[model samples]
Target: MASSSAGIVTGLVAAAFVTIGVLAHQASVTAPADLGPAHATVSPAPGAVKAPRDRRHPDALPAGSGTGERVVYSVDDDRVWLVGPGNKVRHTFAVTPGSVDPAPGAYTVTSRSSRITGSDGVLVEHVVRFTSAGGVAVGFSAAVDDAAAKPDPDRPTGGIRESRADGDAMWEFATIGRPVVVVR
Candidate 1:
């Protein structure tokens, strides 16, 4: 009888332990309540902000200048376009100013010359000079050379001229009467 009583006591203790363990497990398994709205906010790093998307300038010439009067001869990362009228790309090229650098302010084309010398004594003309939106003067010159031989039979033979050096940085097209577009 005593042994049976002892066995009963042992079983009760075991059952109590088991119950305690189950209760503990249940408590541990419960989901945590959602905290109220967070008070502290995190922000992105200084350089993390993405650059603003570039919008197409209204005065900027179209990629193809769709008039059949102009053609897109070359494009650089869609930033600068070399366009010419009458399918003669050799004469005119339109550049979107400040596309490479920020423009100071509104500006206009005061005057243009075919050749100008750099401070380094290198002759680099064939540039369009503009007075900045802030009255500061700036120029954009094409760093291309004319083709060795005239490729287009339609264009005038004498006006299209270029330097003979391979990779010549100076290029000029015959713009005697053609309308050129300049954007700020």
Candidate 2:
């Protein structure tokens, strides 16, 4: 009876390990290539009407942004807005800011990465690097598991996180050298 119980326990442990391995494998499958953010924008299905745009935040713009097209980021609100020609808002979304905030100024999107291990050791996607502060690159990314948990206060965090869907929109909207306006 003792030997049989031990065998059962061993089998259960093995099964748990196998289950963990399978989950890990699935999680490791990276997001699709960064064909710029347009790849994720899907058309409405048959017989389905498109949803109306959200004009709730009409005055969401900060005071310092340019009147021309640009990406506007509000450090106080931790929100980003992609402005189009004539100062039209193309897309807007909230973001998980880092421990450090970039000063209120104009910056350009310097680089982008489809996938990368964030400074916090998280597997991130849709990395859009905008500026460097205190030797750390500040950018936006989504976790592999699509988690948007707040950053750890103890760690030196520089990755401004967003949902996978939002990150995709940002990745598509902001390209290399795209203007970024930071406001308080």
Best model per lDDT: 2
Per-residue C-alpha lDDT of model 2 across residues 11-122, encoded as one tens digit per residue: 9999999999999998786522311111111111235222222368544665436667778876667788889987788888888887766655566788999998898888
TM-scores across all candidates? Answer: 0.28, 0.66
lDDT (tens digit, per residue) of candidate 1 on 1-184: 9999999999999999999999999767621222111111122123422222235643244332333332121122223233455543333323322212222122223455666552222454565443332223334443333323222433211111223331122233323332222221
TM-score, candidate number 1: 0.28
- Top candidate when judged by TM-score against the true structure: 2
- Give candidate 1's whole-model lDDT: 0.34
Ten contiguous residues with the weakest lDDT in model 2: 35-44
- Candidates in order have lDDT scores of 0.34, 0.72
Residue 139 lDDT (model 1):
44
Clashes of each: 5, 1
Worst 10 residues of 1 by lDDT: 35-44
